[model samples]
Target: MASDMPNWFAILQAQSYSAGGTVPLQCETSATYIAKVIRKVQNQGYAFISPSHEATADFNDVVSRFFDDKVLSESCNSWVKMGPGRSRNLVWWPGTAHRMEISRDPRWEDFVFGRAKETRVNRVAYFGNGWTERERVGGVESITNYLKEAGKGDLATLHEAWNE
Candidate 1:
């Protein structure tokens, strides 16, 4: 266990501290806590990546000492990929707009249904125009037809269209 151990493992053992518990710190609960701590540290590192506002430079310096250059670079890239866009409404129009225009525009349902089908892999679908009994029924029927045509057989079929 000593001679064949990896450098990090040896370092961990040398620097290991007791938690005053009967069981070791490698227990499931302890492991989960450690994982949460690591994630928090990573998020903190990401928060300092591109200083949009004041105080970011100070925070970046604090996180840079613990995380290596490669790790920091990767963290910065991940943050950029996951961060919200500068424009909010430009990316995704609200569902209310779909409902309002569904009756007036013949192509509204087609556009909404098509996009929903496309997002099946990501498990995202738009279910607009379900305001009233008649509208809700129409919405359900349209979605059902769209799903059936898309070959989504395993999806739970909605029978009472208006109620839900």
Candidate 2:
């Protein structure tokens, strides 16, 4: 006998917003979904543990683009000391809330491409910011709560919320 694996829908719903307008998620691509799922998995204390070169490259490229586009300007000054062989896994530390790392795995490409449809579906399921303020007020509390909950797990949550 084997224990049942967790359902992605259950996991996602558990992390869904408690209070917000009912806006539907809409992911634009499979790659985006894959990234979000990866973030969620990472947030759960599970390493992405990729098994293919292509997956590793995909992860790296997406991460690089995310940091370069969104984080570089505001948080570039902080430096995180790296071990001799840890350069590849290091990125700028954003105070105590955000940390980024990258590692290589030869098997991720296989997993990603092999389950392309699943990836696309997840990407679609986990898209968009589900909340907005009436007068343009930022939902900082909501956002922080979401991040704190998601960050407690793995990178999968981060990826899922990347576009949000």
Candidate 3:
């Protein structure tokens, strides 16, 4: 595991917005932006770790090293609350046509460190005014999949987007 939080975390979070359904075309563009961030991180070698014995241990370790318990509280934010009982969503915005969250019991670790396997994290289409109701974005996999065919120049754009 990484000894410290990656510098990109703040950059991405700064660019992230919590209110969904307000900005024009935010859903798709935000997804693209977040996917670019995820792809950038993956390029650095981290994988998405779903909830499990392994995830628990990893979450504990990451929190111990990175999260400040004093700063985190039971979030009443609808975005934070809209997920599996145990899992937590971090990068999602209404525009991306997807609902992405850590695939485990609610914890803030993945919010900071990301996860273990590329697919270990959960990604699904979201509908309505961002109430966490899931609808399908047919034939689409994760948002990151959108970049699978991206060329070097495309990646360079993403690097610029994330200041990488």
Best-performing candidate as measured by lDDT: 3
Q: Write the per-residue lDDT of candidate 2 for residues 1-164, one digit (tens) a residue.
A: 00122212221221121112122321122223445556555433342333345544555565455445443334434333123422322443222222111212212334422223334445443333454442237555544544556437467666645435
lDDT of 3 by residue, 34-119 (tens): 55556644554444422344554664555444322322223444454334443334443322333233211234343444444543
Q: What is the lDDT of residue 164 in candidate 3?
A: 24
Q: Point out the worst 10-residue segment of candidate 1 by lDDT.
A: 6-15
* Alpha carbon lDDT of each predicted model: 0.30, 0.35, 0.38
Worst 10 residues of 2 by lDDT: 97-106
- Lowest-lDDT window of 10 residues in candidate 3? 96-105
* Superposed Cα deviation of residue 155, candidate 3 (Å): 18
Alpha-carbon shift of residue 49 in model 2 (angstroms): 8.2
